[model samples]
Target: MNRKDQSLAALVAVIWGFNFVVIDWGMGDVPPLLFLAARFLAVIVPAVFLLDPPPVPWRTVAAVGVFMSLGQFGFLYVAMDAGMPPGLAGLVLQAQVGLTILLATVVLRERPTGPQMVGVALGAAGLVVVGFGRGGHVPLIALVLCLMGALMWAIGNVISRASGATGGLALTVWSALVVPIPLILLSMILDGPGALADGVAAFGWKAAVSTLYTAGLASLVGYGIFNGLLSRNTSASVVPWIMLVPPVAIGSAWLLLNEVPSTGELVGGAILVFGVLVASRTNRIRREPARQAANSVGEPNLSDPTPCTPDLPLPGTPAQPAPAVP
Candidate 1:
């Protein structure tokens, strides 16, 4: 990636990192499901009318929408509202990466690399530590919900991969259309009409600004730039930059929300992050033979040829995987 694109990718990371704080600010008196519905409504409107639907089958779109958009954010919003701090939410949500790997192993029958196994173990251990550290600061149910959200994200990642769609933005925009009604209905049913109405009446500038940042900047702009870079560069180059997100989330939470990580959270989060990094490291040695074979035949040898695994978007954003083309 060129410096310009790299900078753009970094910017996206920052936007996504700070997104947890934005969501917290936006919640105010709004019901979690209702707020999520509004956010997705913002994402789909105007843009959906202008953009063509994604080329993938409607079933794929619907599946991705349900799991990625509704399931992921539904659980996350509820978790946060239930008292999971934004900083820890940001870090814990990344367990989706490891979860995806495990799911792929079971469903797709892919063998895990040693590093990946170790990473998954380390990440799980970290979560256990985080769980033990919860005490009264964080709710166990909230942490469980966040982990469930990560699992939903992993399911969505699998769906996106199976769809074989290259147009991340199109998929994202179109899939968003599936979210609002169900969420609103759920809000009405679960939160009750009275609560929903009161929350909407109480919605203020903070809610509006938070929705704009989440729907406009984080979902649309962030995914736009990140997917654009994926089209022009290797996923290996682009994906690692996502590791920057947690630090930014941690720092932003401390500064903006005045939230501090407990010692357990800090230690566990570090172990988890390090485990994910170890797990994600590609086996260059194993790929050298393939590279040599391609070179001998005069075919172009990509420095990083692994299939791009899409990262789960922050709450309110759809997951956008890069094209599998080498």
Candidate 2:
């Protein structure tokens, strides 16, 4: 990637890392379900007008919307409200990548390389270090919620890959449009007008800013850029950069929320990075050979679509094993 792209990617990373801070802040003012409902509502207005259609089928687009937009945020918002720390929320969310990898293997039937297998081992070990190393108690309900969010996200990744919805900003917008109806209904059924009124009455500039940042900038712009990277780059090249979010999240938590990572979290972070690198290394190596040969022949190879698809292997799916390359 060029310096400019790298800079943009870093900016997105920062936005995403800070998203937890915003989420935490918003949760204080709004109920989790209502917060998600409002956030997604904000998404619909701008997305309807500003975004273009993704290049995928409508079914694929709707699936992406359900998983990535609705389910992921729904579960995550609930998880955070249920006491999942924002800093760790970011780290645990990285588990989505691993889940995606596993799901892709099953649904897409793609096989992982040796490096990826090593990554799985390393990442699993790191989780063990993080989960059980310290005298920390993992919240079962919160962890389950996060896993649900990851599954939703993984399904979205597969749908994106299957449909080749590499339209980036346009696709993000379209996907954002998917869940307004359900969210509105959910808000009515669960939160009720009274609760929502309370939230709105209590909503200050801080809450408003957090909502806008999360829905508009973070989800919209961040995903836009992320999809751009996925569309233009290989999974090996792009997926691992996601691993950067955890440390950034930890730092953001410390700086913003004064939530410091425990010693075990630190150790787990290191392990997570190591594992992601290993899993990504094989794809990187394979791409290198092909890119070199393509360069020699004066032709660019652009076969793989965005890695942000719902086809990524996730938990709760059978291990069907995909090929090395998508």
Candidate 3:
């Protein structure tokens, strides 16, 4: 990768990693759902006009927005507020990697490689280990909520891939817009206007800064840089670097929130990382043959080709304009 790309990636990793701590702080003041709504509101107000419309069909965009923005964030915030540690939240979210791979096999009908299958198993085992390690101490409802949140995130990932705009910032921004209204409505339904008013009244500069960091820096700049990387490198090559997030998140939580993982938690995290590495490496192997074929034909693609339109033929596969998303 070029130095510029590397720098941008590093910046994104830092922003995303730091987001855990910010969420922890922000949740102290605002209701989780309201906090999430406020976050998207911040993003939509300034950047929505600048972003182009989503490339996929409106239905696909809306579906993806629901999974990615509302479902994922809403559940995650509630889980954290329920006493899941910030650093642990980061680790748990990594489960989305495994879930996404599984969903791709199911929804996209892509076959999983051996390593990926093993990786998924290993990740499951790791979660089991973490669950048992916590014994009866951890809240079952909280754990279930976190896992559900991760599943929603995985669904969102597949939707992004389906939309044929997997690596685009415009899609991310558009999804942000698609999510905020529903999120606000949901917050009102669940928390009521009085909860919203109380939360807003409690909102201080720190909370505002936290929301800005989440919306502007983490959502916008972080995803922008991430999509930029995907547009430049293979997912396998770029994704391994994401492994860095858990540790960064853990360290940040340790320093800022004094939230330290137990030995069992650490072991669980290591296993999770190992599982993700295996899955990602396996997926990379699966995509390489297609990439090489594309490159040989002078239609080189930096990322994995979309699988939804197999008949249309990918750039390197043969001369065929890939069908527009239906």
Candidate 4:
């Protein structure tokens, strides 16, 4: 990633990191799936009509919404309800980093270099340190659910990367249309109609403000930028930037919520940053865009209005466009 994009990714991570504090603070007695439904509902209104859908097939948009937004958060909210600590929830969620890299290797066949592998390993170590440092008795089901969330999120990452669609706003909003109803139905079923009704009855200004921030900034703007980054960078190169999130979350909690970071967390935060730097290599290897048209991460400047075409051919591979949106 270039300096400009790296900076943008950092900013988005900070917004997302702080988002946890806001969500926990404002959630009150609202059901998690209902809260998520509200956020996505907010994401769609105005924006959906204002901007056109991404220039991809309807199925592509739906796939992203299913795995990335609905599947990821559905498992997470359920896991948290099953008694996962919010701090540990944040930590466990990032398991997607390793998952994304591994999936990219298997599916996309985008191999990471040795240094990149080491960087990813260091980042994973940082997460482990952070997880251990923030000790909690994790329930087995919640742990499994969280891992499922991570896997869904990783699949979403690869889907977005494969789509090669760089217009983050369009993809984020249009795909979001696939979210609210199913989640609302699930919220009603799992959380019960009474719980959902009660949660809505109790919704207040705190929840509203939280919803605005989460829906407006975190969901729409944040993911818009994130989707673009995925299309513009390799999954390995882009995903590790998320390691910064836990540290930022901890630091923000310290500053605003009076939750001081432990010594281990501090060390782990440093390691995460170093790991991202190592993995996202400062010197980007740029590839000249084919037909001077918009394509993969190598030529970050171009835009593909027609959704995706192909990844740059791997060395010695046939000059055929790679598979996409499967």
Candidate 5:
């Protein structure tokens, strides 16, 4: 990535990092699923009217929504609501890089390079360390939920990669169409009508601002700039930049929310993120030949497709994960 693109990627990391705090702040008294439903509903409007869904089947879009938007954020919001600190949440979610790769190996039949395998192993070890240490700081259930959220995000990543949809706002907004209704209905069941009513009544400026950031700035603007970068660069260059997000999230949370990570978490997160950074280094021998072959025939470089999703572009981004939800 060039300096300008580097700046933009860093900006995305900052936006997404602080987003965990924003999401937590906004859900003050609201149920997690309801808050999530509102955010996704906000994500799709006006923009959805402005463009058509990505040129993919409705089922494909729907599946992406279920896993990416609904499942990922569903578990994420609930986990945060359950007591997962924003900084740790960001760090733990980096597990998506390894999850996406393993999933792709099984589902997409995409073989990972040796470095990627080593990186995934290291990431798994880091998760184990975090798991053993999390009981003191974060709720055990919350940690598990957050990991589930990462797993869902990875599945969505694989689905999008398989579809080969050039990601953009259309895909984000359209796939998001499947998010709100399910969440809202589930929120009703879980939170109850009285609590739901109270949540709606409590919706205020803080929640609105958070929603705007998550839906508008983080989801739309962040994903758009990220897609533009991926279009211009390889996943090897782009995914590593996103690895900075955990530190940004941790720093922002410490400064803003007074949420400090434990020593164990810090060490484990460092290991996990380092593994992801290492994994981001691509196998040029495998990719360059394919890219050259495609270019020689006037074909698009299939190795790097602009993944259009609110949470992830891990198709090739996996093959290390980047561009997933905040």
Candidate 6:
């Protein structure tokens, strides 16, 4: 990756890292489900009307929306509300990378490479450490919910891969259309209509600002730049930058939320990050030919239509795993 694209990746990481604190602040008076609905509302609205839909089938779009948007955030927001700290939330949610690899192995019959296997094992160990360390600081139910969110994120990745949808912005906007109604309906059932109304009435400047950051900067601009880089470079080159997100998240949480991790959580998080680095690492041989060819021709090889799908985060910036989400 060039310096410019590297900077863009770093920017996305910063925006997404701080996003947890923003969400926590934003959800102050608002219920999690209602807040999530509002966040997606910001994502869809007039923007969808202006942008063209992604070329994927409607069913694929709906599937992405269900797992990526609704399922991920529904579980995530509730987990955070149940007292999972924002910084830890960012780190723990990265388990989606391992989950994605495991799922692909089973559902898609994609065997894990040696490095991927090691990465998965290390990541699982880290999660176990984090889980044991939680004790009373974070609820077990909240931890479980976060893991469920990560699993949902992994499912969305498979859907995206199966659909072969590379249209990032279009996919994000159109798929988001499937989110709000279901989330609102669920909020009505679970949180009660009274809570929904109260949340709307209590939607203050803090919440509005948070929504704008998540929907505008983190989701739209972050993913936009990320996908653009993926289009220009190899996935191997682009993916490693994502490893920066958790550190940024941890730092931002420390600065803003004053939340400190336990020694066990810290050790677990480090191990998990290392595992992800190992897992996502790819041999350069396959991409070398394309790169060399592009360099020789002084142009990009557009013939290979590899989708620029990095599962970071979309609208709500729910802690996406690897390849893509938000």
Model 3, position 108: C-alpha lDDT score = 53
Q: TM-score per candidate, in order?
A: 0.74, 0.78, 0.75, 0.86, 0.76, 0.74
Could you tell which candidate, 1 or 2, scores higher by TM-score? Answer: 2
Evaluate model 2: give its lDDT. 0.71
lDDT of 6 by residue, 1-326 (tens): 55676678668777877888889988898999889888899998878999988787899889988997789889999999998888778767766766665565455444555665665677677767765654567788998999899889778766665565566777778888999998899989998989989999999999999999888877677655654554454433444445556666766776787767678867776876786567555422132343444435433346868644433456877763223211
Model 1 residue pairs with clashes: none
* Tens-digit lDDT string for candidate 4 (1-326): 88888898888888878877787777778898898889899999989999977887889899999999999988887787777765667778899999998888777767776667788899999998987777657899999998999999999989888888869889999999989999989888888999999999978999999999999998888899999998878887788888888888888778887877788888988998999899877434333343234344344335656555545678988875533322
lDDT of 1 by residue, 162-256 (tens): 56567777777788888999999999999999999999998899999999988998777875565455445433344444545666687698788
**Each candidate's clash count:** 0, 23, 1, 1, 6, 12
Best by lDDT: 4
Per-model CA lDDT versus the true structure = 0.73, 0.71, 0.69, 0.83, 0.74, 0.72
lDDT of 2 by residue, 1-326 (tens): 44555567667767887898888986685777777777877777756786668767887777878898899888888889888887767767767777766666566544556776677677766766665543555588998998888778777776665555568777777777777678667866787888878876877777778889888888888888877775655443455456657667877887877766678878887887777656654443333354345444523345756443334457888855322344
Poorest 10 consecutive residues by lDDT, candidate 1: 282-291
Candidate 6 Cα outliers beyond 4 Å, as residue runs: 1-13, 124-135, 222-244, 262-273, 283-326
Best of the two (5, 6) by TM-score: 5
lDDT of 6 at 30: 93
Pitting candidate 2 against candidate 6, the one with the higher lDDT is 6
- lDDT by residue (1-326, candidate 3, tens digit) is 45566566556767777898998887676778888888989877767787777567878767767887788888888889888777767767767766776676566544566776776677667765654554445477777888888899778766666555544677667777677777778778988999988988988888898999999888888766665565445343344445446666876887887766667767765786686566555334344345446545544355867534233555778665433321
Tell how far residue 170 is off in model 6, in angstroms: 1.0
lDDT of 6: 0.72
Q: Write the per-residue lDDT of candidate 5 for residues 202-259, one digit (tens) a residue.
A: 8999999999989998878776666556445533344445555676777687788886
Off by over 4 Å in 3: 1-14, 117-136, 225-244, 271-326
